[model samples]
Target: MSLPKVRSTTVLGVFHNGEVALGADGQASMGNTIAKSNVKKIRKLQDGKIVTGFAGSTADAFTLLEKFEEKLGAYAHNMKRAAIELAKDWRKDRYLHKLEAMMVVANKSELLIISGTGDVLEPDMGIAAIGSGSMYAQAAATALKKHAPHLSAEEIVREGLNIAADICVFTNHNLIVEKPV
Candidate 1:
């Protein structure tokens, strides 16, 4: 008998005010069995200018991040254009097409979400999330936005992380957070 593989999920949230937050459970499990804990799924890229939250195969996520960062570096003056190009490349990249990973990236001016659909998407709601805990995080963010007026971007991210942590054992308080100047 063969066992099914288990994948880890990371949750990320960004607010309109340029504040970003991300969380990943410390637990990695394989079919109801714990595999590894303390694995980090959130990463800071482009000299701390971009925050990435990823879900799916760790290797695939890292590969995407590296490629995106290189592209962003080439077009440092125009981040929006760089993002669009990267998204397009991601969709067409043969390796990326084969992997199962989704990413949510937050920069100073834009929040973009990239899923396996091979399309780069920007949400009208000024926020994007990826990973298994994303649904829970998104719900928490919506509630926070409705009930907590004037909350800072960081505050919203904190709230989102808290929500994710509650449901996922792989997530904890030690979340990797970064902000652009």
Candidate 2:
């Protein structure tokens, strides 16, 4: 028997005010075919203090997230340090290096973006997005920031998700969302 294939796109964003949000389309594809369209890609951890969004191989993303969660658990009271440590570990871990996935994470004080390049990126504007619809989501978010600076972080997230949903059948309102405390 052959192994199952998975394809899904995830989106994540963070506002300058330290508010963070994550969104994903429900679609998972297998070998040029649509498999599941309503899968959740955003996860909440550390009693709602941490949020993570994943893109790429679902299993790989889960594995990375598990490692991140463990690190978070170890440093619950120190989110920034925890994030740095997790990103550093993710960048260097041999197993993680082979996985084809991207993740955006946020804790109380900062936002971190990680990808297959083994780079830990923190945008100057304090925002980032990952996955297939990331570009679309990023454009929407940038527009929101320029045209509607007063919008709350949650509102920005909703707008980004709506834009993504319009273009990708895999993403919808039921898309999972997680925010920071």
Candidate 3:
């Protein structure tokens, strides 16, 4: 009765020494089937100044990402304003309201998660994550961040996503990482 959604990515974000990195595994699946093994979920916008990772139905996620890019342009590339505007429109617009996607977005100074419910949230510890394997990735990132202060943001993100891929059936080790720098 529902869409054959592929909300299977494990996108993870981490911060270290004022730098932020975001990464996601390359697996996409629907139900018991692996739809794809190397889908690139990470995107760079604003000339690599903004990095985004998404999870959900692939087409829906692409639509939301495009809308988000438009919002960023309308807001003069201000990450916070664009995120809030995207959330507002996504929640209010009937077409967008039904989108089954979530995104983790980052700029050099901020990391945020935006949802279809009109929520734009910043993690308390400079970490953000989304998608089916988020809890596993987030937990691993948190642990790595706390205990491995020397690790780079990208290192933390990579390790976290790797851990998620090990545990989550929907996630795989083909990772793509990006940083806003």
Candidate 4:
């Protein structure tokens, strides 16, 4: 059986002035049809200290999320280490290597992207985005960080999402924002 490729959302993460925040749109598309409008792509994990956002098949993303959480616990809640470990496993493990999802995992102190190809990335400018509208959102956040450094982390990401939603039909302005408390 062949699985459909799902690219229906946008997720953005930003780290600024010692704070971290993530925002994701609420749109899920199935082929040429809109499947759902309020689907949440960002999630809080490890008692809300850790944040994760995903783009791809929802079911596959959830599977990766569960594995990533296990890695977190094994690595003692160290976000970076857990991300790296997950990437390693995702690329090397037969079953995991086939999972179709990309993830951004972050905390108040760090931001990283875990990919199925065994890549774990930390954005130099403290911003990262994924999914179909990722480029638009990333560019917006990068500009905000460079030109308007006074904006809070939440504001930067929210504005980024807004911009992405405007240009990317798969994305929307209905954003869920989360920050470290």
Candidate 5:
């Protein structure tokens, strides 16, 4: 059998009411076992102007985040430019090309999902999610956005992630949420 690799799952980002919030569950899994809990997968980048959530192999995700930050700096903090540049490099760079990770990044007005396959997508519905529990969290966020108009972006992310944690065995309740301020 192959050795187990630790990976993180369940990340959600919601843009609502002129605010953007990104969140992620804290469970890291190794094959069928939980390797760690309370691993923060959300961060504020560009000196708090952008919020980011990551999912996939823990070390690979960190590597991607660091590369993304470098792109942000090189691009003068333009999130779109940075994300696209990161995705471009992630796809072509021999080293980065081997990484397995995805990221949801946002500023107050824009939300984007970046993948190693050179995709930098802006969710038309103002929500983006990645990792194993993404679909569950995405569905939950969609319903909440439609029916619970009063909920803030962070609220939607929290509730949606919680719902995902309930449904996805790889996900958990320990969450880290961040918003650009």
Candidate 6:
């Protein structure tokens, strides 16, 4: 029996200018093939207080998002605790551990990456990116944030994703940006 195919995309998140924003390119790919565009890979959680961006298997990501929501509720809307709880479960649960996905989660105060490897990481520079275009987007955002102190968080993420789309074939122009008001 042939195994089901998994899809992936790019996700970026940053904290800048006293704001936190997350962005994602809306392109999905399967084995070098473009499957779809305009996908919403970034989301708001905890009554719109936290923003999360995800990469890797779409199905797995959706499941993780649900699980994360539950965790958030369990932790009383604490972003860090919920992320850590999700990571612990993701790593320890045999079935969940096998799911392929990564997440960048943020609030006005923090930016973090939760991995299947049981890691909940807070980026040193308060910026994080994941997926195929992650390296390119991260580098671009880092440079921009350092050089362009006047840019808003949304602007930095938009430009970062644009740069990633230029370099990564799996990334596209359909972008979604979310931040807390």
Q: In lDDT terms, which candidate is top?
A: 5
For each candidate, the alpha-carbon lDDT, in order, equals 0.68, 0.74, 0.91, 0.90, 0.93, 0.90
lDDT of 6: 0.90
Clashing pairs counted in every model: 6, 4, 0, 0, 0, 0
Query: Candidate 3 regions off by >4 Å?
Result: 1-3
Better of 1 and 4 by TM-score: 4
User: Model 6, range 1-181, lDDT digits (tens) per residue?
Assistant: 7754557677888899899889999998877788888788988886678888899999999899999999999998888999999999998999999989999988888999999999999987878999999998999999999999899989999999999999999899899999965
Measured with C-alpha atoms, the lDDT of residue 39 in candidate 3 is: 95
Order of candidate numbers by lDDT, starting with the best: 5, 3, 4, 6, 2, 1
Preferred candidate (TM-score higher): 2 or 3? 3
**What tens digits encode model 4's per-residue C-alpha lDDT throughout 17-115?**
899999899998878777888888889997899889999988889999999999989999888988998898898999988888899988889999888
Q: TM-scores of the models, in the given order? A: 0.83, 0.85, 0.97, 0.95, 0.97, 0.96
lDDT of 4 at 94: 94
* Candidate 2 vs candidate 6, lDDT winner: 6
Best by TM-score: 5
The better candidate by lDDT, 4 or 6, is 4
Q: How many backbone clashes does candidate 3 have?
A: 0
- Candidate 1, residues 16-44, lDDT tens digits: the string is 55455544445555666767766677677
Could you tell me the lDDT of residue 146 within candidate 1? 75
- lDDT of the structure predicted as candidate 4: 0.90
Query: Which residue pairs in candidate 4 have backbone atoms (N, alpha carbon, C) closer than 3 angstroms, thus clashing?
Result: none
**TM-score of model number 4:** 0.95
